[model samples]
Target: MRLLSTIMLALFLVFSMSGAVLAQEAQTNTTDPIIVGNQDAESLQVVQSYFETMDSNLLAEDVSYFDEQSIQAIEGRDMLTQSPTFMYGDSFTEQQLTPLRYIVTEDVVVVEYTFVGRNTGSYATLPATNQLVSVPTVGIYHVEDGQITGIREYMDSDDLYTQLGYPAYTGVQPVAPFTLPEPNAVDDIVDNPPAFYGQEVTIEGGFGEMVGPNAFTLWDEDFIDIGQEGLLVLAASDGAFDFTPVEETMLRVTGTVYEYDRASLEGTVGYALDEGTFTDYQNFTVLVASEIANMDNVDTLANVDQQPESFYGQTVTLEGHIGDTVGDSAFVLFRDQLVGVGGRVLVIAPDFDPATVENNQVQVTGVVQPVDAPTIVTETGLTLDENLLSDYQDWTALIANEVMSVE
Candidate 1:
């Protein structure tokens, strides 16, 4: 999902003055290490040792510590050599990596650290940033069989290039489309859907907004922002799938970004509504899934208030107190759902029927709609509340596919 720029920036030194001075926590290489029934801690130790060894200018010695076919995550299934750690080591006269922290989980060791060094050397034809840099970076190490099988480093490449007084690198790396079962992160797909739409993409995230037994919303990591619900995911049949839909459960889905929303809600419902047209409906972005699976990770809930700042079509789950359900099929959560009062969203859940409890804590998982979230009042011939609808015209709400309680 990220790019080689990340690697290039990471290999750039932090700041080197006199000798390659490095600072790190106590390094431990143990035979019988704490496992906690997993390899996380062990993998972390390997990464720590690898970086510590690098500081000692012993980069070649640690090459054996990686898998023979080690992968660089952003290199598109290429060997780690494509990212070229050896070349990086040879480029700088003095390099130092300061381990900021280590987060171990799911067989991955995330090293949050700082890289510092002055470009007193050269790599290939490129010269260094004479100025010492202190770029913060996070390296993700994937461990398998006690070896680091893959590594992905994240950092702001542009910032590093600017600071170094180097021309921005505009060449695109050789990254082919993902093979089947592999995925492009939802972030990439959402950033520019027109370019990625119609292409097969595998997205993994929180599974909430169960539209039906076979339909739901795929909430990306940025669900709390205005740009929630990456897209609507619909299956063939309500009961024809393999994975179960649980609120906040991680879901990995492979699908094509099919139908574009031409109108708010197609058919007579959206046609009859006097409410102004919603532009996102015409964006030509929706998901028709071919395969769905569970992503073995836990996703946190997206805050309700912030769901509008990013991707609006995202599916998301949020928790907050409910104010009213008096508007028939719709209820309010995360904000004032009551007519004339809008906060986060008004939930439209036709199937959800519970005793109205004012200010009762509840969880709503659903797809984000643009300005005009089509409602039944305009669709199924229910009487419309003109004043109430006008009151919260500018706000957005969730078309709840599933609703539950924090209790």
Candidate 2:
């Protein structure tokens, strides 16, 4: 009887331990889908299908995935109504979005993927020629209650531009060759016939005959006049000419050779009529300003108050010291130019450093306006524009947009 009782107790303890183990296993299965193999596979399959549908939409005319409440960082808008992912004038006929990996965390799922699009039309007015531009991107999607509430993407712009064959810069070409003309006189060139038009020519003489903003001529020691004849003027494409802002200095020019009517000359040379005409000239010009000249083009608070309506959308130049940062942006202005008592002009750049540009006297050509206090505060809480964020990833590529030469 005693042996039987001991056997029964041992059996009961074993059964109780087994029951506890089974209950713990069930609890874990309920908590984590991966460990228990319950619903993760089904959930992932649905998510994958959703992504596949999104890829189809990207290729088709439908952009419903970016419906209302969808904030696009690249377009700097909250919805797809204002910012379309498709190129400005192009339509996507085929695309492939291959998921490289999917990392599921506690509350978010990160989808790593490669996107290849066969572009068939002009992208931002640039000919696409049906080229395939493959871009790798990583997207983080916040999943709560089985729905995505937010998304962020990271990618490169240089890869996109290289695939498109667009020039990355809109500024003046900085490097070119120039030699000082011998005999130090502009009169020699005017008196002597130009050997060639659009040919590399060297001129030497004191700066003379100031023309428009950046237009000037040279004169020989004997004061012989060398005008626009045989000279090529390198003008800014944006129509904003930068010069030394000083007078009477000897300089040399090596650029495309061109001829303009003497009567039609606005300054030193007439504008090139075509791409072929301007091809030989240096794309940019350099000014050797030794002193500060009157920068009347820049607007001031006092001036704006006096003529409030005139300052709207007008591109003005300014110089000033750096001030406190508003998020990643900064404000700057000279003490003399500050409005009220110690108020400075606000300069907003997402990734600009006041220390790098402060007191350095940069020539900024942008519109001046009053800061919207509410907007500034609101922007801090909002996510960054995806397109603007992409610009930081690749320094060599220009942001994708319709950029016309301001010249």
Candidate 3:
């Protein structure tokens, strides 16, 4: 990307005076090449020979063909280490240089050629685009004794870069207009819903079931230990985003948290939360999202199992198929229950109906806690059978806030 600008500037500084002297020297050569703008056979041969070496990728021989002053000029542009095929060879594949025009002016041979190639390599740090390009390039060469004594080349670098998928050049790297602070975890916001109420905050969590045209649930899979179900997201204003949410996709929501209230939400969103659909969400935290994006990384159940102690009080989001059912409100969740592979975790969802998601994929968000049947019964008010209680004793369990069927 920097090649054209660097060479132009360097040549302007180094060859301004040397260029005139080179042309004069070329005019004094034994063949006495033409001083007018007409095609001279010998001058064409010298320039063509140089390009032949380039098209053949003959680096050492091509460098040998250039005189000391021309070599220094090329080195001044930091091109000494490059192949004779030059920047185009490094940034492109299947290169073909077809000389389109040759004009001899005052003993200098001006050659115009079409550089055809596939963009299969990086230009500086820019990535390869795998695109084909055929751009015109111009080069001026001073020949004396059939050797290139001075050289200058020109091409539209911006056009080349943009054709290969780079943004329009502003002579510098582009910067974002604004930056957002790190997002808060949905579990942390849920841990004390009132703390985030009425405040604009960004929260990251799992994408839950869509309850309305523009509203959906966002939950932390690792936050199941609590009694809350999930944070309801009101995304009614913007319509759908440019992506479809899947089971493993984690979403980051930036909005103001509000205490769930139908009348209050209807006033803010300009639409009703619907009577029967959101009845169970009363007293829960609701996020009125202004922006939403996918999170690059999210913690999984296997990540928790690798170091259970580290996530004892942390909220986690995990998606998996429902495993063996322990009771009406509890079931074993496995990353891949069908193959009996991957990590597994115990989930206890109060008011959950196992029949609804018998063999379906589900995402669970909750806090990790040690499996104490007595403590669980005290916290969740679940009447667990003796055999089930004994089976999970001394183990780890996620006290789920939300459990939803997923893809």
Best by lDDT: 3
Cand. 3 Cα-lDDT: 0.63
Estimate the TM-score of every prediction. Answer: 0.33, 0.30, 0.29
1-407: candidate 3 lDDT, tens digit per residue: 23323444454335323555457646654443323244455666777776777432322333322211121133322353454445454778888887655556444566656788898887657778999988766666655555554555666666776778777555432222222245776767877988878899988777777775777778774322223468888874646445576763578788999988889888887766678887766756889888887654346665565566777877787766565678677887665211111366788887666555423457788888777787788878888775875787755688899776652
Please list the residue runs of candidate 3 whose C-alpha ends up more than 4 Å from where it truly belongs after superposition.
1-36, 52-72, 76-87, 171-407
What is candidate 2's CA lDDT for residue 243? Answer: 54
Residue-level lDDT of model 2, residues 211-274, one tens digit each, is 4444444444222211123233434232434456344443444343344443332233434334
Number of the top TM-score candidate: 1
lDDT of each: 0.51, 0.39, 0.63
lDDT of 1 at 262: 34
- Model 1: how large is the Cα RMSD against the reference? 23.5
Off by over 4 Å in 1: 1-40, 54-87, 128-131, 167-407
Candidate 1 overall lDDT versus native: 0.51
Arranged by lDDT with the best first, the candidates are: 3, 1, 2
Task: Please say which candidate is ahead in lDDT: 1 or 2.
Answer: 1
